[model samples]
Target chain A: MASSEEFNLDEYILHHLTDSQEWHLPFLPTIHLPEWLSLHGVMLLLSSFFLTLLFGILYKKEQRVPKGLTNLLESFIIFVRDDISIKYLGKEDGRKMAPLFCNFFFFILMLNIMGLIPLFSTATSNINITAGLAIITLTFMIFGAIYKNGIKGFFKAFIPSGVPAPVLILLIPIEIAGLFIKAFALTIRLFANMLAGHIVIISLLGLIIIIGKVALPAIFLAVGIYILEVLVAFLQAYIFTLLSAMFIGQMLHPDH
Target chain B: MTAATFATIGAGLVTVGAGIGIGLIAGRAMDGISRQPEATNKIQTAMIIAAALIEGVAFFCAVICFMALGK
Candidate 1:
């Protein structure tokens, strides 16, 4: 176990929050290996395992009517399917894409919620995790667009129909850049939201230590921020999944 | 200024931008919701998602600031 003195609050928070990755330095002499496994990776696995267990328990009973945890889970699943997936991707496409979107939504939701738990870290707080998700969505968008519109149609969609030949030259690049920027934005957005919430909470708490025990107002501020952070936990998760669906929807029917 | 102070500033700017973006989104969503109460669920849901996306960007900015401060 690490000593308390060796790991202060800032260090403790940073240590828990950092990712574990192996880096190579072919041209350089030093490459630091992170001391801890990526919290996001662990949470990803844990959420998957929990989802499996929940499904297994539900299946084992073979209950015709939903009850208890199963019912709650069913409602969430239905909400994603009906509201997010179906509403965005449409019935036929949504049905096909349901599992992917469902997984994405629940996985992100669980990860966001994890930060709220004491002594646990949030996976979604990590940039790599959010970037990975954004990349996956980007890939789906690209492939889905190609599949729907064909390669010729896909490229053609980049140029707005009303633009003249001369303007098309500039518009096409701008449009392409816009597509990439949107995906890049998604990555930064998720990473920033999750990280900021924790930081605010930490900074608020840090005030007690910085200003000493007599700072009663700081304590109240910290408590208030904590409550806001709780709302943020849910809000961030909802936003991440919603933007993802919107991106997918745009790619699916670009003409709109 | 110390790295930590710089980070604090950077994080502050990010949140400010996010606050503005969210305010706009919420304003529009509220307008829609008020006009059509029947579509409140849909509007609210869309608003929440848009808010998250904006928040995500702010979150990214915060993380970068943290890293800068730590170093």
Candidate 2:
């Protein structure tokens, strides 16, 4: 119900960016648990719950053959498995990893899209959320590599073939650094894209107020940015999922 | 500069960095696809995924800006 004129740009944007939390613990000081029944938490739970229910319904009706929504969902699943997982990970290994990759994609895509809504704080926009996702991917990459190549082979994989002994001294450190860097980069990408789109949209909207009542041009610019942001919402989500699949694929087939 | 101004600058830089990274990824992907048209789907998919990984880093930078600026 707040008007643009009355609202402070920084405060307004901050309010939207802030996660709804439960009461702050007086004793714990640092622990600011989201209010147990916050809108954000509730939305997250509900979205997850509904997704699970949909999956259940599809599973139970498996014998009936896919149709309508079920058909669409099945097609998407098959596309990710065949196109992304198998293409990168190879057919045999890709099947095992498909579900995990698919889940990560959809979960992130949904969360990113949710932020575009009028009154939602994107959980994926949070560092904790993005970091957790990066960690999950990292865990999969490390463990999957070790599992496929064995511990010795895993370490050996870092040293590309044909490198001289002296070069290895430098290569080993660079390779190790690259491994961690890739994971750290993954964490930043998703978080930044989501956050950037929102900030831009909010800042553009703030322009109308900043320039005062006479700035009609600013209003038009803000509208344009808002539309652009809508497109970015989907693009960012797609980018996040696509990278996750690629990382997993790389780990699955280091030779490639 | 006020925290707000700093946050704006920080966010702008992150996006610029992401743009450059994605441009590189897409360029390589296109080159790969051209070499093997039959593998275009696979190459395109891989490119998109790589772009996302880069985006994740940019996202983290933005988050830091938000934390610094937000009350």
Candidate 3:
């Protein structure tokens, strides 16, 4: 970004998007964290620590009446339990799995919201992190199905009845691939969304740098995208949890 | 033409495809909600799920285009 000989716009935008040891912000000096732990790593750990401390302290009060933060957290938990988990999985399994679904929702929601804050970076924007999260969902989807339905039932779920034996040869592979494709879609949907959002925001600002004037409309557009990013942060988290519950639900009750 | 150019074009087409698919879904959903306003909540939920599923495919292809651009 520093105009040495010639400034490269692509490099500027990509640099802001990619994770690094140093945190960069407009009109502020770069702050360098430890080389071993990248900026995104710090953001990831920060969100986890914040969530744990917030919940651990608030719930430890053990109040007969829920207070401010406790009230908020409880509401979110109920939303996850009822709207997401129970709605998809049956009542019994939904209750059993509410905790895991809550963890996914809050962790993702926090990670995303943290990114929107100028002080922190977006950890979920990274492909590896999103892929890791999707893999956890995949593990539960595969194992939960097998556990509830047994091995025979797991495979049986793939083979729909009355789909002639001749069609079975072509259908089996596609059905098997569909399982993995769902997880792959989950990974890309998250990574690309965050990636695209950051890129657009940076590019909007980059226009001013490249063109050598403070583009006022560009600033407004960036702010608009920033707000959309916030909405997306929440939406993506909800969608991920919703889909994960849906996948597991589908597995548990294949007939449904 | 360069590979990136082709990838860019392909991504544009993917977006168009996803746009039409979602448009169709939202159109039908609107009709359903208008006919049975009481079921609006259920209809909206189904609409969002379907739209998100198609958006996922679009993003997946866009990511592949990005890989090509990176190369």
Which candidate achieves the best TM-score against the true structure? 3
The stretch of ten residues in a row with the least summed lDDT in candidate 2 chain A is: A22-31
Off by over 4 Å in 3: A25-31, A59-61
> For model 1, what fraction of the real interface contacts is kept?
0.89
Query: Could you arrange the candidates by lDDT from highest to lowest?
Result: 3, 1, 2
| Candidate 2 stretches greater than 4 Å from native | A1-7, A22-40, A58-60, A63-65, A209-230, B1-43, B46-71
Residue range with the least summed lDDT across 10 consecutive positions in model 1 chain A: A22-31
Which of the two, 1 or 2, has more TM-score? 1
Compose the digit string of candidate 1's lDDT tens values, residues A13-52.
5654566453323456534445675445666777778777
For model 1, how does the per-residue alpha-carbon lDDT over B1-71 read when each residue is reduced to its tens digit?
89899999997898789899999999999899899999998788778776766665676676688779878
Largest DockQ belongs to which candidate?
3
Across A200-244, the per-residue lDDT of candidate 2 in tens digits comes to 777877776677677667768877877786777667655655566
The RMSD of every model to the true structure, in order and in angstroms, is 6.4, 5.8, 1.9
lDDT tens digits, residue span A1-256, model 3: 3783588888877777788889876789888788799988888899999998888865645778887888888888999999999999989999999999999999999999988887788899998899999999899889988999999999999998888899999999998999999999999988899989999899988888877565757999999999999899999999999999998898889998
TM-score of chain B of 1: 0.92
lDDT of 3 at A67: 79
